[model samples]
Target: MNKAQRLLHILMTMQAHRKFNLKELTEEFGVSKRTILRDLQELSELGVPLYSELGVHGGYQLLRDRMLPPIHFSDKEAVALFLVAESLKGYPMLPFEAEVESALKKFYHYSPPSTKEKIEKLRSHVLFHVQERGLDTPYLTSLLEASLEGRIVTITYEAEKGTSERDIQPIGVYTASGLWYCPAYCFRSREPRLFRADRITALKIVEDQSRRIDPPGYDLRDWFTGRPSGETAELVIHLTRAGAVRAKSDPLLAEGLTVHADGRGCVRRAAAISDLSCLADTLLGYGAKAEVEAPALLREMLLQRVNEIRELYAGAGG
Candidate 1:
């Protein structure tokens, strides 16, 4: 790990154990005792009350009486922190907005001079977009914490056109298309399912006894590593020449597409597709050049949506 990551790890370790010996720190980080001692000293200088204890049971710890200034971040850490701050801004439901802002200020101030200069360049070069809104960052964060601790959580979720409260044992958090979702075993539904963080309105951690069964055996790491099973759809799209040209330029649209000979442009068989709304919007952007071929239901949905759009715009005079 880099220096910033190591420092963060050290802080987390100290938070968990409240104290650790030199040997333990050196062994855990695979660094020499000398190096670990230097890092600890640096931490102390940064206003981390890292006090060293004498004798066998005593070791390094945050001094009880003093408050520590924020830890310094390497360039990479600063960039990552800034990106996360930007992401959190998109989620209005997060309760810790002030905390995130505070941490970001400290990170920016403590970043190396070289990294500080790169921040603007990085921001201009990198970008991310999220379509859904009102995501409950606080709730999502709580669920992740609960999953790590194997605890239960109660959440108020807004379903399509309605709302209800539920208690669930969250297995893990998953991200797809710039949105975070949680997979859990809902106590009310008594089944394993997924929930979009954007739809969650409130959350509370329940006692551990609320767990219904030993948490599901599904491998959470495997589930969130990529597209989880059951989240994707298979479709066949027929694109005209213009549509194919435009789609070929889009990495997102072209993924998992197999082209077949059609009269005008080509037929594409697609799999593992999510966000049908985005798909329709993209196709509509190509005007009449793109049309769904198979999955008649999806085709009709797109066609109806297009027709509605035409009607809505028909009154505009030349």
Candidate 2:
């Protein structure tokens, strides 16, 4: 076999046998010991995490997080992966931002010239538009790690009420509307609460195991698809054609929307009381296109906001 083919085979072989000696590779590929040694050096240079041992029981070992063997992808699969990575560019921050960019660069560098041209053309035509957000979520990676490890963390959060510190065990971190959020079990409140990632001014893992709380197995999918748990009231809103079109664009509101053949629709779902103010703000933007039909509390909140706006404008005019 050619040197190039032999080198690839050796990498695959080493991956299969995590620990091997130069003699074994020499015998397996029918190459000289010196040549096998040179191949191992080349692999090391290519960032394969390999190390040698001096003791009798030791030979060569791949590190626990060794680089994976090369993977072949079809043209379509390559393009799809590129598109997925490209979509992340819309977000202001990501837990693995550097890794994504590195992988994308490698994909572009290794692809055939014709495939590169096709990818460049597709980049211009395909776009995943997300609203740009100014806030930076520097703690996204830390929050994600805490969730995976089931560790508690103390965060200095800047909420609407004011800045405060609290300990929480995070369920997970997710992004929507170009902003990052963490759903966690707040020790201070003794309940699950969502916090804006960017608002976390400071964070550090709570190393004291005694302070850790057993977090619920809360599925983020439920947060997206189903109504929140605990006390909630039914919300119903009549929508005009334009309102229906606008509501369909919202990930949360669209879940409960139903459209009829006449181009009209309604939003009917159970909404937590704690969420009414935020819901009022969102629906208020719909203006005359949407009319609240149920839930007196939400209507009241909307009215209060309207009055506040009118009062401010009146004072300005005066």
Candidate 3:
């Protein structure tokens, strides 16, 4: 965090906790004691109440009952808050929906009128199209809160086998591909595992006084950015001219595809196949325009999926 953000955070922490020594502040911010001392001085100059006690364990303390005054959010921060809140606008059954409304109101209230007006205009200039999958995320807020508080939760989750209970210490919540997921340390798995938030049928926060805390500096971004350790079988497919054109419309499919003069195309490199049913559905959508050149396993799976689709349609028609 920048100096402005750090100063603002220190002021708020002082207000909330009443006392924080230089050592505690330095450790929290990962800055030097001198830096924290300088920060405290800056906070004082900014009209924050920061009376310091001078003793062996002397720490700066806000006066009792002194609240943090209204803060002016930086321009970038205001815009960022607006964007982040906007992303959650059209979700299905979000947890703490009322809190979200309150937060958005506060964000707008704190934003400069000029910034608010510009944001209104920017709505036309900036657009984020999200396809909400209509999954119930009732426990999202609780899970997120527990993650921050280092609390454990017991969850009854539906999986391929059946519903099973797990005691998990959540690291954080994240979103990908229109799904919310929580990565947590699971007692059942004896390791960190990602749980699909929608599959959680029941949730109970473990309010026991003692609970396992998430490891310090546990970051969801690292989990997302790290290379996945799942199996990825490669697909070597040949596409007709029409299929190639269609694939071009989907950047993922068109990636590393090479079209030839004969109006047939092959992947410049083999494509990594993850979901058999999804790939089958896509390829089948192209009719005879797509042909699997290699991978007998995939071909069989695709054929099986095709037969299933055909049977379903035939029965429906009958």
Candidate 4:
């Protein structure tokens, strides 16, 4: 294997074993003992906890360090990492910001010369979807870290009712409409909910010890896989000329909703309606351009919202 590939293999071996001796690695890689020693030294320099073992059974082995940097990635991996990090620019305040930054810094620092050069090229050529109205990146980053670590978060969330501080158990990070959203189960509601990463003004990682308390039989993946539930309905949305572009490109809608061009914009159909209120609001945001075609109930849902707006604004100055 080439130097980069060899390094990756050695790292993988170290991760799998408590230690590796020069003789074993040399035999494994068909290299000299000196070369294996050099490779181990290189890994050590990169902040890997690889250490040489002495005695009869002693060999080079990775020390158990939870804080050790991960093995180097291939060229594609290097570029992908940068892309992921850059994308986080949309949500800056996530709890994992420091960890992500540290990991990236180390990865770049130890990346092979060719891989580093490729990363530079990739950085110049790539573009991320930028939000017209930006969000606080740091907060989003923190929320992400907390969520990944299974920590409950406290945030002053603005709901339709108004603003309220909620202790939420973040489940995963979701991206929608060029913005990141966190899926969580609200402690108050005891149900699954989504919080806009951008709209969250302040976030605090709660330490009350409430944990991965998913509902009786809640499976995030299965729920998102369009499972039917008592509280949720299946709603189909048909988009007009302008709405097609968004429907086709939106990650959330694109996965669950079937889309096709209808000369005007596009038509989308889906059978999951866990958040009809939010979905209706999204459709309304498209104005008269989008329509809910199937499930008469969803049509009524949108119409009710429209009537409410009409009633609220009637006789008011525009």
- Model 2 residue 224 CA deviation (Å) reads 2.9
User: What tens digits encode model 4's per-residue C-alpha lDDT throughout 180-284?
Assistant: 678787887766677787677788877676465745544446546644433665455666656667666755455555444464544443444556666677777
lDDT of 1 by residue, 1-318 (tens): 988879878877886677789899998999998888888887776557677779878888776546543355566877777777666555454434465666566667667778877887777777666556444456766777777777778889986548999888888776654567787877786655677777788888786664546735655764434452334566667677667766665534565444546534544544333345556655667668776776665676688777887888886642
lDDT of 3 by residue, 221-307 (tens): 665444333454666888889888878765335656788898778864443344444456567777788888667776887788789
Off by over 4 Å in 2: 1-7, 19-47, 52-60, 209-218, 315-318
RMSD of 2: 3.5
Output candidate 1 Cα RMSD.
9.2
Q: Return the candidate ranking by TM-score, descending.
A: 2, 4, 3, 1
- Highest lDDT model number: 2
TM-score of every candidate relative to the true structure: 0.51, 0.81, 0.54, 0.62
TM-score of 4: 0.62
Q: What do the candidate models score in CA lDDT, each in turn?
A: 0.68, 0.84, 0.74, 0.69
Off by over 4 Å in 1: 1-104, 120-138, 174-178, 187-191, 208-221, 224-256, 259-318
Per candidate, the number of residue pairs that clash is 0, 0, 0, 22
TM-score of 3: 0.54
lDDT at residue 12 of model 2 (Cα atoms): 90
